[model samples]
Target: MAKSNERRTNIFPLALVTLTGLFLVNLLGFIDTQTGSAFGCGRDWPLCNGKIIPEVWNTHVAIEFIHRLVVLADLLLLLFLIAATYRRYRGRKDIRILMGISFLAFSGEGVLGAISVLTDNPPSVLALHMGMSLIAFTSLYLWTATLRQIETGKYQRFDLQDASSVKQLRKWTWGTLIYSFLVVYFGAYVTFTGAGGYFQGWPFPTESYSQAKTALLIDLTHRLMALILFVLILRLFLFTFRLRGKREDLRAVSLQTLILVVFQMLSGALLIITKLNLIAFLLHVSIATFMVGSLGLLGLKASSLQEKERMKEYNL
Candidate 1:
């Protein structure tokens, strides 16, 4: 019993470390992509330039190699977390579900990365790689945040007493998350497709080369979707802010989401104005990733709290 208690006590910090590692790996992977270094290791998987370590060091090789190393370390951390969670919280279906997702996403990300290296990383594959990394990162994040909430006893206040309201908020938050993810994905797709270069203006394409009409159209659609996402996030924030007295957690998450969306818009404009500058591009995608993850956290909490209300109503 004492050992189990000790393990539970340590879980939150361990999860936090693992989550941070995953986030760093995702950022490094994007850096690798943005730097056009995917082929740096010369179509090698689990090896750098046909060796465990590269015989030659160049900027591209260094970036890709470092990304792979970070991925390896993060995967080890995730595996340890999985084992710990199984031993300590095996009966927790939510924790188990999150672990399952984190495992699958990380695995998929690795496989995709390998395939991308082998295939020269076509635009679609590269985009999917980013998407998988985000999924893995978000799952671990959710797991860690859940542990923190439980440890701090903050989850107890999730009982809003009104199950219907919880359900409504959960649905709305989730729906918005889905839309935000689509927008993010399309933005990535636009980037990888090389369509972002055809646009000459922010919020609208001022001029288009004759051969780049499709690129222009795609970029325009991406901008429109972003506008709609901003409105959705704004509405979500207003609604949650009104309920601040009841669920400060949700209100805070909504505020964060709103702030991220605003920054995302600004970053988008920067990307356009700078003609897809690497820093601006990273900021745009990174903010969108966290924004979607924040909404996911909000929805998951409400969903869990709503379940508690259900059990209470049924006298379980």
Candidate 2:
């Protein structure tokens, strides 16, 4: 019984990590699509332009076709993880809840892909597709962490004081996460609107602000939110440093958050400087995803640590 339970407990975190890797690959596919590489394979869904292999070689075709392949792989991995989890934790409410979410998210991603192709690659649908993929990634991430705790015998319960602090942190962290999403959406808008190619220069349109208001607005909003996040993370680090009785886990999370935010900001600026080069753009997207994931992990760690501390106090 103990051995079986141990095997079940270990599966969730491993599955979650696999899911995150797949999510990263999918984001790469999105970047490829945005760069006009979606039909690189000549409009073939599972094959390269109706051939097992294409006789003609082109950058766009290679990118688009590879992206499709990656997505297919991701789907397979997710399904396998779900099946394994169900086998192990079929009756547990928490496992069932996460499995349901994972299933729904995978379905949504597939629908988005079909819609993108059917709509002749509509930008709105494509962008929303990427967003839904992120949701699926995040769900798996959370579930994986939960499983890790269970395996390590480190799962902690919350009390009133811990709950209050966590509530406050949750509010701030969630807000930051939402703001990050908006920044990513605006990036998609920049691509869809052809705004990146418009200015022909860095940080300014060729003409006055009034003529390029929409593009300018999108750029400005993303920049401003980035600034806000940087400051907010800086503040969080300071607060964590100053707080009495701060757990090691909380401090570690704060430090990691600060590092990720700085890297994200730098990557964004580099993308601008490179004039939206494909590699730069992908890096920007990847870093943004990383920031979101890190912040989420930090929030969870803080909450769990606080709960542990509270339990300790009560015991005393």
Candidate 3:
């Protein structure tokens, strides 16, 4: 308990800040990609034009250069947090496990990102970059919330007044988390395949449109995945809110999840309506990141119910 209190008081704020910084840097990366500055340095990575600072510079080069610098700083900060988590919370196996997972996912993202830069940003590589970012973001977000849970010892496990609701929350949240990852990957998949671009407008176009058979299939499948995700989340939200007993926390989670899904759908529309505008595209990715993170939070919270249930069986 003393250790938990010490960590809560000493380390949790830094964790939250680190999580936000990770999220922000990834957002910047997306903006850099959308703005077409990814090639600003002319395929020379780690150094722009073979100089620590480019002697000849333009807007694109400057953006890319600053982005690289920020990434270096972000990596350093994440490492510091990871080391601190190990030293300060080593006794807590759960926290250490989360730290390890976040570190590996983040490292994989960095590797993939570097590979893209060195390889002139291949379409297939770029398509998969955001998927790794999704994993890192979700892992770190869960770690942050878990740290707080450890500090305050607020499992809210005994608050599970309705066994049915907790069961539903756990089951549906697991499903949503898994399904959302596929949706994100397919979202990226459509971009590199040129499927989305070939199909103008979203949901239903103003008139009939035709495209290559493959492109049509990919684009339609992406939309179909989104529709299915929407239905699942909507059903979960209704279940979360309908619990007759005290499940306000789950209700709140449901509310946030529902809002993110709605905005994700809106951003998808904007991606088409704006003709794949850079900012709109960035918005689409940003919302998807947060929406996935929200469900990650739900999964973390849902675990507490299970843990408390086990405690009851132990007659503790």
| Top lDDT model | 1
Residue pairs that clash (backbone atoms under 3 angstroms), model 1: none
lDDT of 3 by residue, 1-316 (tens): 1222543465677788888888887887787787778877767767788888899889888878877887788788788888877786676555666777888888888888778777867767887787888888888887788666665656444454576667767888988999999999989878766667765666864333354566777777888999899898898788877763476677788779889999999999988888788888888998899899888777766665436533543334
Global CA lDDT of candidate 2, please?
0.67
Off by over 4 Å in 2: 1-5, 9-13, 43-57, 90-95, 154-160, 197-207, 210-213, 242-245, 302-316
Span of ten consecutive residues with least summed lDDT in model 1: 306-315
Q: What would the per-residue lDDT of candidate 1 be over residues 1-316, giving only the tens digit for each residue?
A: 1112434768889899998888888888888888999889998788888999999999999999999998899889888989988887676677788899999999999999999999967888888888888888788888898777555544343444666776787788889887877887788789998998777677777876575778877887898999999998898888887777788877888888898889889888898889888888778778877888887888877776435533443344
lDDT of 2 by residue, 1-316 (tens): 1222445566866686677667666776667676777667765655677787787888887777677777777778877777877776565555566668767986797778766765687777777877777666766776676566555655434344555665676677767777666666666766666666445444333545787777777666666767888888787667666543645555677788798888887776677677777787777777766677777666666654434433443342
Which candidate would rank higher by TM-score, 1 or 3?
1
lDDT (CA) per prediction = 0.81, 0.67, 0.77
Q: Give the TM-score of candidate 3.
A: 0.88
- TM-score: model 2 vs. ground truth: 0.80
Clashing pairs in 2: 40-61
Candidate 3: residue 132 Cα off by (Å): 0.3
Off by over 4 Å in 1: 1-7, 156-161, 209-211, 305-316
Which of 1 and 2 is the better model by lDDT? Answer: 1
Clashes of each: 0, 1, 0
Residue 277 of model 3 has an lDDT of: 83
Of candidate 3, the 10-residue stretch with the lowest lDDT total is 1-10
